[model samples]
Target: MPSGSVALSARPEIIGGPPPGAATLEARDACAWFGDRLVLEGVDLVMPKGKVTALIGPSGCGKSTFLRLLNRMHELIPGAALDGEILLDGNDIYAVGTRAQQVRMRIGMVFQKPNPFPAMSIRENVLAGLKLARLKCDDKDTLVEQSLLRAGLWKEVRDRLDSPGGALSGGQQQRLCIARSLAVYPNVLLMDEPCSALDPTSTRRVEETIDELRGEVTVVIVTHNMQQAHRVSDLCAFFLAEENQPGFVVEQGDTLEMFSSPRDPRTLDYVEGRFG
Candidate 1:
């Protein structure tokens, strides 16, 4: 929304204000802790209206934690507490008026492992979110069709919507999860290591889906695969942690610059494979 100022070079320009009707979500000096252990401290970032921002770091670096915080999922964990603000469309999600269910509806998530509801059919899984949201009225078929198509899974499973979601292949299942997230039509989609368990071919398909889904929803992914980050993200944020320390953001910039001309030496080392 701000002009003439660039945050991450690889990040697409914000253009004008909130993409002509897009919601504005931002995290300002946000901090999270589980009991006495801090995970993220004073983390500040923005999820541009309809762009993908990838969070990358080695294991235990809090990338997943950050993802959870975006949608208030962190608070669901026992003993977890949060401070500061997570603003959705300029309203703090932590505000009393903001309920957890409401926050999740606006910021849907996909997991590292495909956890399709085993009891639910493909069609049921896709509509699960809306069902929870209590959304009603016309065009149920149209919404399901568009959601599946948008997830790039329609042609493969169009005629078998009644089949169990677990009956799908690993890749199809992941796409099914994507469709599930899309059903709610969230303003942002958080994916945590979404392709980690898939094969190369499956990863490619999911990445392609991500590329296609851009401008339709804001996406934030946490991944250990640097190449995947480069291939799929518009912006990149690097995280790190040391002994006795919680993970913190080391550097964040455009994927191109972070991979090529990183401003931090640690980022350069990690990207160059000198360190994890």
Candidate 2:
């Protein structure tokens, strides 16, 4: 058996879902282009507000590109253009006068590598987003505690809040990055292979953190690890691209059904290791 097995939790993510009615992100006919080449096309996906949705596929399948579009990061690239609507609770994020910065704050992202400011202390790293977002936060200490606790790092690093973020182990730094994202109180969290670099032990801890975050925040993750997807995601979206075609979601459904009995033969092949 693989060492990356996730330990199951007994708790439901939360008591229903997001406050009153908020945050059901949807992609409507979303397409992305880099220069003249199209990477993703005609993609439509609904990410439930309080569930974890995993995007999985072979490399170069545009999973990461689609993930970046949620927060408008794809627009940063030179010659990159996106057409179609990415809606947050019925509001089109790409609509006129919608600030990308606010969109990013509402929908935060964590990269594959743990990138904490090397010179800043751990607590400072957690609080860094406030400065960039130019928002003042009262209850500073409480925010730090709450953020670290949510990331599952408070117990281990509680005594060393003043220590440099770079001083922690790779996994701990990743968690600190996660805490930084959570501190903003984003409605949706985007993780791009957040645990791909860690050792087995650290990976499991990060997976636990992801599981714990389900009810409190919306999570959209792009990962190549089928086992991890099955272990952590509530919904699984399988993306694929033919030799010269733009990538699109081939199938999406409950994680269990996707792994146990996928509708597409290609999905079954990829999950069963028959082909990528």
Candidate 3:
């Protein structure tokens, strides 16, 4: 097994049929670049199964880049390249014969912005992933309801299933995106500042959804919001890059410990509003 990779164990039952089973994601000696410029280097971290891990750092520290690497999204950028292994359940996702599409299916992503197909109805938006992945569901109605319920948006939009997804409020749209991701039943969910674009109420709702999904999906979120990170995450990793240097992990541990008793001065400074 790669360093930081944990053995899989039996998963508890979840709402959407037999659990897809949460997975431990491990990055080993991970380095990323855009063309010839090294942006992130030597990052090794373990995202434990069925827990929320927050990547908290200042802007331009490569937190988003690192999150993209886990699901093979990094390769989508022109001139983007990465070194080292990203392990899912101890298997290398970047290994030969491993298809990018398959990796993405197992590891779904929710972006910084809510991106629902504006023309698609709410029901269609939720089932979009299944259609794109060629996954068949015996009962689409039940799946939609279950997904929306899990995302904490079912009651609000239950009667408006036929409404255009874009017609919903910003927070509702974001939760709809979460429902879409959940419909595919991914083992690991990657969120990039999921609540950054929402109002406070919407942010709270999204955070509530994140808390509810804990222990059912392994979640890795990148956030500049320290308070949100502390509230929603079980583990935290702090990344830092000095002047003209490649970004790297400065500290990582339990969320409470990282906030209350961080060993590194940089972490303390960043967390206490001293500096990024």
Clashes of each: 1, 0, 0
109-213 in candidate 3: lDDT tens per residue? 999999999999999999998888777777788778878888889999999999999999999999999999988788899999999999999999999888888
Any runs in candidate 3 off by more than 4 Å, and if so which?
1-19
lDDT of 3: 0.90
Report the lDDT tens digits of candidate 1 across residue range 15-62.
211222235568898778999988788778877877889998878888
TM per candidate: 0.90, 0.92, 0.93
Residue 26 C-alpha lDDT in model 1: 82
lDDT of each: 0.81, 0.86, 0.90
Candidate 3 lDDT trough over 10 residues, lowest sum: 2-11
User: Number of the top candidate by lDDT?
Assistant: 3
TM-score of 3: 0.93
- Flag clash pairs in model 3: none
